[model samples]
Structure formats: structure tokens, C-alpha cells
Target: MTVFILVSGVFTGAHVWEDAAARLAAAGAEVHAVALTGLGGPRDAAGAGIDLDTHIGDVLAVIDSVGVAAGREIVLVGHDYGIHPVLGAADRRAERIARIVYLDAGMPQDGVPALAAVLDQSLRARLAERAGAGGAGGLGGVEGADGELPPPARDEWQRWGSTAGVPEAALDRLTALASPQPLATLLQPLRLTGAAAAVPTTGVLCNGNGASIEMVQLRVGVGDPALQALTDPRVTFFELPTGHWPMLSCPAELAEVLLRAAAGEGHRLEPAGAAEPPVHLRPFLLDVPEVPRERAGNVDLYLPDAEGPWPAVVFVHGGPLPAEARPTPRDWPTFMGYARYAAGQGVVGVTLDHRLHDVADYERAAADVAAAVELVRADPRVDADRVALWFFSGGGPITADWLGAPPSWLRCLAATYPILAPLPNWGMVGSRFHPAAAVAEARALPIVLTRAGLEMPEIAATVEEFLAAAKDCGADVEVVDVPHGRHGFETLDPTDESREAVHHAMRSVLAHLTA
Candidate 1:
């Protein structure tokens, strides 16, 4: 197999791909690590004139030199910002290109510029400010030789650009070799025909930094055209455990993945822990206010004072009551208090009441929750990618669909002493609220179920059976035991133990969001 690898933006050159290239060569594939113009040491007046077309020409020139022929396909790979130009080249040389692989990267939509499409509005404004402040030949006003953009600030790069697993030696080398990015490259919009669309594509996502392919899907969904281009059915998706820079952290594994893509066997990702070690949540900000909403079923928003794209949770209260007795969003004082607590802890908390006039109303509750999710995602304050569901008491089974086959956006589910099974008394026979059976359907999505030590016999037995069955099925689930507690302890019993249990469960859910 013939392969071409393009490195991410704000980097030196082909040196970043050394490990991956060497590994590919060892695997009997011919690899080309092409350096784009105006990057690395081939600096011309700090790359004042280098743009998207220049970089595209650079890859095309490499392909011409490598000499592609019929039946000898080239596997074109790009990481981060490098993906933009690679897409351009792939479209032009569609015949010789067998596959296009994007490594923790974004794809080009017809008219969107690379940077504008990738960065959120806030971040884009910041970048624009910095660029405008740059000096002559520098991006913004930050200058480098030959008019190139300057590298990121040390603190910023350390926090966001680098990862934990990379060796210190590699970090030092990267820091030394890192070059300034060119302004024109990011500002230039890509032009493409249908040729690249016709070629097979694979998106090899880097999940080491707590960002997964599912999270990316949630971030844009099928709604955003740019994200849809990379996530459509024609593209294959896989996850890598290393941070954004997999070439430096897990070269051998990365090489094997590329080889598999070349062989038409990269459709499925390697099992989560087989190729890369899994990550768990660590206690960080175990750490929040209330605001009322008038519309969307009278939902109330409890928010933190801090600016956020904060991980949010939809708190569903339980009540299988008559129409008049049923609580509206304005009611549920206990849930509202909990939502306020969540806001203080930097989470966007929503306490919305679903219809519960009859036993069968639980089915409609799911639809209500879905609507809430869409509403929360549209808010600028919430991190749509890291949202979760929290069901209390009767609300538990109502969210069965979300628990079993959750949308990509849901990070985890927390059921506080929930009524998970369809009880003989509820009078809803043949209902699909069997959480035990639904465990397998969740795949590996994280779930936290809180068990009240002192529970009614029937509910206790059902909870036990569900936990056992979930374990047997290898589901990623855990039980938070609240010994000496009764149902709704978090809200009803304000003792130290009950408070601690609620806090612990909330923290765990936050950890899952980050993970």
C-alpha cells in the first residue's frame, strides 16, 4: 500500500510523522510524509503568501513525484488542520486515491473556511483578535521569520496542545521543532467537486483526551453540514486511545490502523481496551443557582454564575399521579433545589415535569425528555456534547429508551433509587421498561444506579436483578450503595450520609462527562 500522511496545523513539518511512517514502512507499505509549504524550515518571509491552494499543490506535487498508477492506490491521511488540504488533493486525484483517513480532524464543506468551521464563535473571536494584533509578517501581530504566524503561548500549548502520555523527550523535540502557523491557510476556503466524495473515507478519532467520536457526533449531529460530511454512512469510524497526537504517543498502533484502512478492514474500531488502555474519571472539580423558564413546557433552568459550555443534566422527577395531582415544572420544589445545587457545581441543571395523568403517560415522558435535550443543546451556556440524564423514582423507567439506546450526546445515566421495572401494581403489562434486558443495548455507555438500602421489597428485588444481569452482560455500569437510606433519600432525608451519597453520585456523573 502507498500512504501519504499530513500533520496537523501549528507544527514544524514531516518530523511529527516519523514514527508512523517508519511503522508503516516496517509493515511493508510505502509511506510519504509530505511537508506543506510555509511550514517547518522552508520559511519564506514567514509564509506571507502561503494559503490553502499552496498546501494543496504541495500534496499534489508529492503524489506526482511518488508516481501513482492504476491499481496502485494511495492511502491519504490527514490530522487536525492538515485534513483540509488533503481533501482538496483527494478530490483532484480521486482515481489514484484509494482511501482518505482523517485523524482527529474535521472535513471541508463547500464554502466554510477551515478555521471558521472548526472553532466555535467565541474561540474564533479570540483568534481573530490575536491575529489582528500581530506585527508585520506575523499572524495577528505575533511575528515569525518570513511573515509566518507565531506558535501558541506556553501555558496554552501545555494545557490544550500537548497530552499526558507523550514522552518528555518527544515533548522537548516537538517544542523545539514547532513552527508558526500561516494565516492564509486557515482563512482560505476549500473548493471541491464530487470526486473526493466518491472515494471511501475513514475517520480515526483520538479519544485519549476525553473526546470520542460519539461526542463529536453529538457536538454537530446530522444537523451541521460540515460535521455531517465526516459522519455520514459512507465514512467508517474508529477510535484511538492516544491524545490528539497519536503519532507521537502510539505510533505502532496508529500504523496498524492505517494498514487496516488500506486493506479494507478498518470499518470497526479495535475493542476499547485491546489496542489502547481505557481512561477513567478522576476527581477534579467535584464541584454551582436557579432561574425559571416560561416556555418549553414551563421548564426551569438552574445555572452557574461562571461562563460555560458546562456539562448539563436533565433531572426528571417521578410521579405516577392523577392529572390534577401531577406536578408541573413550577412545582417539584425538591428537584428545583437539587437543580440549584447542580448549577453551583458548574452544571447546567434542568428540572422539567413530564405529563403523568395515567400509567401509560410514561411513554410520552420519553418524548418530553428528547425535547428537553434539543432545547438544552441549543443553549450557548450548555456543553451539548457532554450532557446526561438523571431519573428519580418513577422517572427511571420512563427514560428506558435513552438508557438502552441513548443518543450520542448522552454521556451517562444516573437513576436514584429508581423504579426501573414495570411492577405488577403499575398495571402496564408488556411494557418495554426492562432495564436488565436494556443493559446490552447500551453497549458500553456508563451508568450509575443508586440503591437505597431500605427499600420496599418488590422494588429492591427488581433493582438487584437488574444489577446482576447488567454485570453478567459486561455492561459499563456501577451501583452506588446508600446504606441506611430509603427511596428519595437525596431529597427526603437531609442527613450527612444522604447528602454525601448525592454528592458522590453527582461527581461520578461529572467524571463520566469528561471521560
Candidate 2:
């Protein structure tokens, strides 16, 4: 695999991405750090003539220089100002591209210029004033200085603390190599076709600035075209804790994230674990006709050592592993762990693999869940009337059918850090995945909802709206608050908080069945 690391322009160089590039290369990926025209090295003098097209050509040239062919897949990663040119290049060569990653960068759709898409009026005016003052031909410094903007001074560095989490030494090198950005590049509009839309994309959001996907969605509704493409079904989202300059501040973490993205992993909000199942339940596999059209995997059953006619819970995983992953049973360690935990509680725990090619597959995956529920019910070992659906992150929407009019067999529904909304490419267009809609479709069945304290704004908003609607309808729902938690915190980083949340979720599931 090859990853072309595109650096932000306006005084930035390939050196800025050195750590990330090195790490990616170490992970067996062919890495190329492209320096746009007049942006790095002594070529800063030639930046006056560099336009948007010039930088676009620079990316294409680098692709050619790297000798990427049709057979080998390549991942294109763009950071900050680099998003535009990379998109332009990706538009021209989307066929050979495997995935495109926007690292805390603008996501401009066709016809929108990168700068106009991301910059607010205040930031625009600041850049303009800085560019005009600088005699270095329409290039501005970070601090809005005139004439070949110098390295960031003490105050400027302080201001960048949240955005650039690099150490002092790295920051020094950054300013030392900082060059000038071409004004034309910012003004240039990008042209693209439907081809680029087909490429799977990931947005590595840097939460250091307090920006979240929920905020991005709000911006999209108010005529901000920059985040427009992110609303698409094919684009997945991830978050990093560092500031804007993750390459310098959190290179190792960034690299690991990119590797997972390239391999079609981490699409889920959190990471899976490798914990072994409890000793009481033994794992057994039952053969079933494979579902047609890919995304069909094994169904493992965890039966308690105690007795028959036990309550059952079907565990559905999130992260919808990409097609490129060639996933095996091992890919879902977190869900398997959950199944084991449930089995340890004397319940029949089931972990299933369903088709999740994209968000639109929610309906298909739901069908699979129904099938699994039927299979579990038919088994003499499980209680036919005591079963529930347990969904996580990407699998949250699969509960739509159950939520609308639950069957007599399903005792309750349990969802943990679920994306229970019709956002982007994860669910069917008219599906009842929206919490408000699901809650409105009244049913007597009980429900358990868990919310992360440090939840992503999008999920947080959905949860609040759901709870409000549930309360208004007087639905039988239990709300569990995981204070000091995050989205998918259970799997990403196992802590006392996550453990407590899981226990609460299980408790809620049990309370309904026993009641």
C-alpha cells in the first residue's frame, strides 16, 4: 500500500509530515510526502505564480513520481490547506485510489474553493490583510505579517498551543521551515465529477479545537459547503485528541489511525478488545446458509454451563468493517467479549456477522438480526419469549424494526453508544433509525439507552432528542448515564467508567426480562 502525505501550504513543507510518513513507511506502506510548488525549500520565491491548478499538478506529479500503477492501491491523505489539491488529484485518478483521509482538514465538494468552504469571515479577513501586507506577492504569515512572513514568534506559538500540539523542538523546526502560501491557491475553485464521490473517505477530526462532526453537520445545513461531502454515506469519521498538527504532536497515534483506515479498520467509533470469554460459557458455532451478496460471516453462540431455556441476547457489532478488510471471526473481539459477558450472566449470548457494506445496508443487517433472533428462538436451549437486541455504534440503526413494533418475544432493546440517526451513509434513507421517529412509534416493550459523557455532538444530540421524545410519549425506557465517558469508550479504552456502563446496560436488560 502507498500513502501520499499532502502537507498544508502557506509556509509548510514535507518535513512537517516526517514523523507520520516515517511511521507509515515503517508499517510497510510506501510513503511519499509531496511539497507543493513554491511552498517548501528555496522554491518559496516562485510561489507568486503558483495557483490552485499548480498545486493540483504538483500532487499528480508526485503520484507519477511514486510510480503508482493500476494494480496497487494507494491512500491519499490531505491535511489543512492540502485538502483541495488532493481532492483535485483524486478526482482525476480516483480509480487507483483506495481511500482518502482528511486530517482535520476542509472537505470541499465540487465547485467550492477550499478556503471559502472552511474559513469564516473573520479568518478570511485576517488572511487577506496578512497577504496584502506581505510584500512576498500575496502570501500571508500565520500572524498576518507583511513581506515573506517570518516564523511564528512567541505569542503566535502560544496561540497555536491548542491547534499545534507539537513539542517545542518540533514547533521550532515548523517555524524555521515555514514558507509563504500563494494567495491564488486559496481563491481557486475545484472541479470534480461523480468519480471522486465513489471513493471511500474518512475524516480524522481533531477534537483539540472542540470541533465535532455534529458541529460540522450544523454548518452544512447553514450553507457551509465545505462539510457537504462529509454527509455522504461512503465517508466514515474518526477523532483524535491532539490539536491540528497531529503529525508533530501525535505522530504515532496518527500513523496507527491511518494504517487502520487503509486496512478498513477503526470505522467503528471505538476499538475492539482481545479479552477472553468467561469460563462458564463455552463457544459453539452453528452452520447456517450464507447470506447472499457478501458480508456474511459465522454466528457464534455462547451458552451458559448452567441450563436450557435461558434468556437470549443477540450482539451486533459497530464499525461496519469495510469490504477491503477481508474480515474474519477475529475482527469482532469486542462484540465477542460482550457475548461472553452476557453468557457469564446466565443468558444465551450470540455474536453475529452481518453485511454492512455501507450505511444503506442497515436494512439488510436488520434482516440478518431478525434471522439470528429466529434461529436463537427455535433453539431448545433458549427461551423463545425472552430475547432482546443488543446493538453497538454502527449496529444501532438495526433496532429500527424492533423499536417500531417489537414482537412478543423480544423483552427489551439495548443500545450502547449507538449512532441512532439518519446521518450520512450508515442507514436506509427512510429507516426509523432516527430516535425521535423510533420513539414516536409507540410500543409496550422496554428500552435501554446509554449515553457517553464525552459523546460526539451528533450522538449526544440524537440521545437528548430521543430521551425527550420518549418522555413525551411516556415510553418505557431506561436511561443510563456513563459520566466521564466517550463514544465507544467501552472498547476503545477499557476503564472503570466503561465497565460500569456495561454493567448498567446489562442490568437494564435484566430488569425488563425479570419484571
Tens digits of per-residue lDDT for model 2, 1-515: 55555556445778888888888889888888888877775346543457789888988887766655655667888887788888899899887788888887765767866555433333454555655575225444454543333444534543322444668888777776766555667766788886877898888877654456544443343223334455565677777866668888999999988888777654422111112332112232211122111122456778776767889888877644454443333234566667777777777778777776445466677787788778778888888889988887667767777788778888988888876665421213344656567766757878888878888754565567678878888988887888787765654546776777777888789777656
Cα lDDT, model 1, residue 45: 31
True-structure Cα RMSD, model 1: 17.6
RMSD of 2: 15.2
lDDT of each: 0.67, 0.67
Off by over 4 Å in 2: 68-71, 117-123, 126-151, 157-161, 213-233, 268-515
* Superposition error at 169 for model 2 (Å): 1.1
What residue pairs clash in candidate 2, if any at all? Answer: 10-181, 11-179, 134-146, 134-147, 135-147, 233-425, 268-319, 359-425, 359-426
Superposed on all Cα atoms, the candidates' RMSDs to the truth, in angstroms, are 17.6, 15.2
TM-score of 1: 0.54
Question: Which runs of model 1 end up more than 4 angstroms from their true locations?
Answer: 5-7, 42-45, 117-123, 129-147, 153-155, 159-162, 216-233, 268-515
